[model samples]
Target: MKKWLYVLGISGSLILTGCNGNAEDTNAETENQAEEKTEEVNEQQVKKEILKAQMELTNTFKPYQQKITAYQAAVSAEEPDSETIQSTGKEAKTAASEAASKVEDFTIEADLPEDVNTAFNDSLPSLQAYYEHVESALNENLEEADFTSAEEKFTEFNNQFNEIIEKAGFPAAPDLMEEMS
Candidate 1:
């Protein structure tokens, strides 16, 4: 009876230890899962920020595009109304200037990779330069305009924007140079 009791006691202790080991493993697994979930949530947040920044950048530039469209339509009119052309031209110039100013303020506050953030932040200046060029070219009370350099500047910005967004796991932005012409 004494030997039996000792054997039973040892067996019970072994069983209890085995159960405790399993509990520890379960706790570790749960921690790993929680960490993974948090990482996924953070990644999603970064993506959202990148997308929002892209939209803002696009929106900021849109007014200038609309004004350009109005100017183009006026210029292409059969009679080529000088009054309409001048008004639209001035509007476009103002829009470009406004866009340029806004671009400087349009920053991606996303917590992204350093390269991605730098690329995004750096690209905006090119867009600003594009608008500045357009503004300067249209500064004089304009009858006609040439936007070759401005388009080039825009292309530079667009390409950089596309690269950075793609790096951040998004598709390229729209090609706007043709529309500009």
Candidate 2:
């Protein structure tokens, strides 16, 4: 009877050990799933932050696009009306100045990755430079040269800005820039 009791005690302990192993496996699987979920959430959060920053930057620059198109039309007229040119040029100047002001006030409210934040922060200065060039150019006679200068400055900004956007893992920048002279 004592031997039988000893045997029963050993069997019960082995069964409990097996059951504990199964529980540990279940816990491991749950932990892995929770980790995956957390990673997915973080990825989505980063994406959202990137998108929000892009929109704000675009808005700051969009005002210039309209005035540029108007100025382009006025300059490229079949019979260039000095009156129209002067008015459009003034409007473009104002728009550029406004963009510069906006650039000064612009802030990225999103918490992005370190590299991405640096890239984004770097982009605004280029945009400000572009706006400053246009503002100064419009102070003189509106020439084809002024438009070309604006284009060059714009290209520089665009290249830098687009690279940052791509690095953030988004689609190509939408046609944010209009047809500039």
Candidate 3:
């Protein structure tokens, strides 16, 4: 009888230990799942914030892009006169100057991820540089309207802008020659 009692006690102890171990494993699995869920939520929020900033920047810059397209179209028209070229240049220059000023006032929302903010911040300097180049080219054209030089500058600007947009994953700006066609 004593041997039977001893066997029952040992069996009961083993069962209890097994139950405790299973409970611990379940708790660990739940914790892991909760952590993964939290990470997914954070990633989603970051994407949302980045998308919002991109849309805002695109909307704000659209008018200036349209002005550039208009200038390109005007100049590319058949047998454009010196007066027409100069007028278009002045208009484009004015638009570029205004765009540069607008860029100064632009702000990304604070909720964006740090990496996204850094990317946007880096992108702005290139845009600013391109705008400055545009202003200078237009100013030169206004002073002594040269269709040859104006066309060259326009091509150069478009190429550079396309490269920049591709790198930054931003929307493509209107193409000058494409608009003319």
User: Best-fitting candidate, measured by lDDT?
Assistant: 1
lDDT of 2 by residue, 1-181 (tens): 9999999999999999999999999999999999999988987888888878777666656667688678878888999888888888888889888888888888898888898888878877877878888888887666552756666777777788778767656777644475222
Q: What TM-score does each of the candidates earn? A: 0.70, 0.76, 0.71
Clashing pairs in 3: none
User: Would you list the C-alpha lDDT of every candidate in the order shown?
Assistant: 0.79, 0.78, 0.66
Put down candidate 3 lDDT per residue, 1-181, tens digits, no spaces: 9999999999999999999999999999999999999988887676566656656766777777667656766777776677766677777788778877877777886486666576666656555555566677676666443445435655664565455345445455546345422
Per-residue lDDT tens digits for candidate 1, residues 16-131, read: 99999999999999999999999888777777887776666566567677887788688878899888999999898888888888877787655677777888888878888998
User: Candidate 3, residue 22: CA error in Å?
Assistant: 2.1
Q: Global lDDT for candidate 2? A: 0.78
Runs off by more than 4 Å, candidate 2:
1-12, 77-80, 111-115, 178-181
* Poorly placed runs, candidate 3 (over 4 Å): 78-84, 142-181
Winner by TM-score between candidate 3 and candidate 2:
2
Worst 10 residues of 3 by lDDT: 172-181
